[model samples]
Target: MACMEEQRAPGHRWPYGPPWRSAPGGAEPGRSGLPWRSTLLLTLFVLVGSRFSAHGQPHRVPLDGSAHALLLLACVPLLWRYRHPVAVPFVTATAALVYLAAGYPYGPVYLAVAVGCLSAVVAGHRRAAWASVGLLWAGHALVALWLYRWLPPAGDKGADLTQEIVIATWVLAVLAVAELARVRREQWARERADRAQAARRRADEERLRIARELHDVLAHSISVINVQAGMGLALLDSDPEQARTALTTIKAASKEALGEVRQVLDTLRAPGAAPRAPAPGLDRLPELVEQAAAAGLTVAVDGEPPRLPPGTDLAAFRIVQEALTNVVRHSGSRHARVHFADGDGMLRLRIDDDGPATGAEAGGSGNGLAGMRERAVALGGTIEAGPRSDGGFRVLAVLPLHTREDE
Candidate 1:
């Protein structure tokens, strides 16, 4: 029962568990957990080592049946190296030490110890890797001393020096390769995380932009519709012709609103589809003034708008539209003036109404003003809006044309 419980413990499985698994989700059945390819390669190394030992290679220690079993014990644990990176190196190193102490032949069985060291480093077990290296060097020195005292010399001093150099070079190379792989994996993960964050930020900005569009389109249209409907109802019994005209204005405004709304929805639903109409810009200001006049607000234009970048033009139009809508719905203004000017590489817009400030203007949540400010600021511009001291409300926006051109 204790054995079963140990196996079931998180990250403490004897053969495989939490830290052994690749990342959060489980790895493919044969690819990660089982590692059949590595098993096959280890098997090949064992076979080759056995054959070389049997043929009396100078470097190979002769192996009896018990030494052969010890060799298998050292190498077989490598199958679980990835699952227990730190543990695997310690187990293989201990097995190799036992084999060496028992005077078994040093053959390809040491390959398992090298692989475990590499695995520990790649698995981010830095302390374990250093410990394994220290243990390996200490064991090697002790074994050499034991051989010098108890066994006949197989080679000269020069031959022993060359072998030591080669073994040290091999160990350093394994560590270098594992460190490089870990660095590369970490870099890739960081880059993937950055890309995901950028995508989410762009998505949030797009949602805000779409919301602003919908609010401007719907709010302005519904305000006009409400005014016209009210006028029609007030005049229904006395001025039938004027009432019919008001109803006609309402119908025209509603139809235009529906079309604009559908266009925005189409662009949202099918981004690759052809646009139903060009976005509103400075050139559409005349039509906007007409719409306001028809809705019973007398609007006057001061100067002609210069040609502008698409983004700036769209932003300018929305700013004017939102400001005019406020004058009509909240300002209680009969007359409003829109002034446009281009000078000093900046396009300037000023809208003022000769009406008393309403409660909505002073104490409202100001989503419209906030949205307009966001749009202007996004284009590297500024806007100021407040109730005028003389008698009314005013909004002024300054946009940099040169900045748009440079972009």
Candidate 2:
């Protein structure tokens, strides 16, 4: 804008041109590989229109073989414009300049030069486009104001001020339009890239969500199943009735795990569909205790957990489930306790079990504690798990009472 105002200031050489802005490299090439259709149309328009232009301006030299050749020269390079953005505009501008210096009537030849410049600017070659158009305009100004007397049809006078001003205005308009187009194209490219990145982020989040769900459900249930299987195996020969009881627990655990797995898979099969059953929450604490007892870990619950939003409820349940699963799989203690508290719109749940350091050989597949932390943090909460100085491991989670959706 300041450059444009400078040109309009009195006594500034408006007949020359405006300063050009530096720009980045052009947009990527077109996939169509060739612009044969548009290039051929431009050539045809320039060739057909020159005759009418000559008739309209008799003082200008009429079109002839050399003139026709020069016009084609200007139009032909446009065939490779996208493939060679910088070179194409300069070639077209130089050809047009030579044609005009020979005093060929102004016609669609300028249209060819305009196309070349536009192509260059849109392809991310703004400086080259500006320079090329400026070269053509400067060459025209030189020939019209001075060289007109020495060349072309006899007795052509110096171009008037009005003619030079009109030519300058046209040059300015072309550059302005090209720069505007380049800016717009860059904006669209940025929008497209942003959308793609957002899509990938959403995909990653969904995959992580499914993974956490599967881990919580299977880990807790499988820990129960493993214990029951061991009990059933040992008791199958002695205490047949107790063996039957352990087998029953194993069957129940396996069935629940499969149902939850199917639910997770159903979501993948039909996205945007509601779950076939509501998600588990802290309300399922009694069931978790039953499962833990069946797994040979006695769990004592401390306080009543408040009802929570569906999302918070699910996260809370998964955190507790994972914590208890870690206790069963990683701690040697046969007893664990869950302590829950609510205040100031926050819920804190801590699971602890007495422990001697269980050897690293204790088997578990995924990072159960890490998974717990993820669930807590997703709901604007936090999780901390470490062995206490009292010779016990502890998993603690603090979740917000009001989630963003609830807020």
Candidate 3:
């Protein structure tokens, strides 16, 4: 699983892993073999220190074959420190101890130990890093005490104490820097995850809104066309003039449905395209009523429409359109009344039909009603729809004007 995750693009992950780990035969997955940077740094440290010692640096360790081999054991494994953080630090520190115990001059072996400590911490092995630091400090102190007791003094005790303090400070500084890097890496990973999740949620909401728009457009127009076609057939022989009117109504309804559908498809195809026209709002309510009346349902408006925010206006228009369409398609109603009221920052709408109850009116699929409620709720409103005790169906919606404006 770690290998598969590493195979993904670097931008999709935390930026702390070895970059070339995916190269052919580079290293085992999740293991950084010998990175070129680590190799370069270690080689430079050994070569320069060896050259300096050869130039008669009396206190430096001699570059004899055995000492060189020990140095290699301490430093070379650091190339794979990220792969085995704990083991690498222990190996390097152990080799350094052995070299010091052999009475060889203390040279650059401690550089390898410092590198191991840093790698372990940055690799998120906090326990391993602390253990390695503690072991290195203990080993150095014990070795110094042994040398002081057993060997002839080459310098004052004050100088030895200063050297030990300097070395301890350097190790602690390296650990501090590595820990800071790990914290930053974790923060970046969390922020990236949050951004990806937000993007998914936005995509889901856009899809649902588009689905509701398509349903409302298709359902209302299809219901009108169905009613007009029936009326045209009923009057084909008895009244040719009336039949021609019904056919005209069908043609108009089909044309309107096509235009609305085309607009929706065009917007989907070119999301950044300029607006072609304004969306239908409550200003078009009279036209909606006329369409229903033409379809053989008597629809009456009881009050003047109130001013609304664009979002609320569009939602209100759709709710009324859907409710009237339902009456025509399923209520068997001959007369319906649409009442509107504005009071205290709220716009109230009610559609009631005077048709006899049918099975559809009592227990229906209710997709239209569900869509209406969703629209209302999305705009901080509520909708109540059910069969009325007096005989027909009623849909009541209360939308907060101030809430829409605030949003």
Model number with the top TM-score: 2
User: Comparing candidate 1 with candidate 3, which one achieves the higher lDDT?
Assistant: 3
Q: RMSD in Å for candidate 2, one decimal?
A: 9.5
* Colliding residue pairs in candidate 2: 26-123, 26-124, 27-123
C-alpha displacement of 102 in model 1, angstroms? 4.4
Per-residue lDDT of 52-156 in model 3, one digit per residue for the tens? 655665553456777777888888887777567778888888888777655566667777887777777766788887787778777777767555445323441
lDDT measured at residue 250 in model 1 versus the true structure, 0 to 100: 88
lDDT of 2 by residue, 256-364 (tens): 9999999999987776777899888888889999999888889999998998999889988888888888888878899999999999999998889998667755457
**RMSD, one per candidate, in order:** 9.1, 9.5, 6.2
Which of the two, 1 or 2, has more TM-score? 2
lDDT by residue (197-306, candidate 1, tens digit) is 66577667877887888888877888788888989999999999999999998898899889988988886777557677998898888888888998889899999888
TM-score of 2: 0.89
Rank the models by lDDT, top first.
2, 3, 1
Q: Estimate each model's TM-score.
A: 0.82, 0.89, 0.78
Whichever of 1 and 2 has more lDDT, that candidate is: 2
Candidate 3: 10-residue stretch with minimal lDDT: 1-10
Q: For candidate 3, what is the total of clashing residue pairs?
A: 0
Candidate 1: residue pairs that collide: 61-105
Candidate order by TM-score, decreasing, is 2, 1, 3
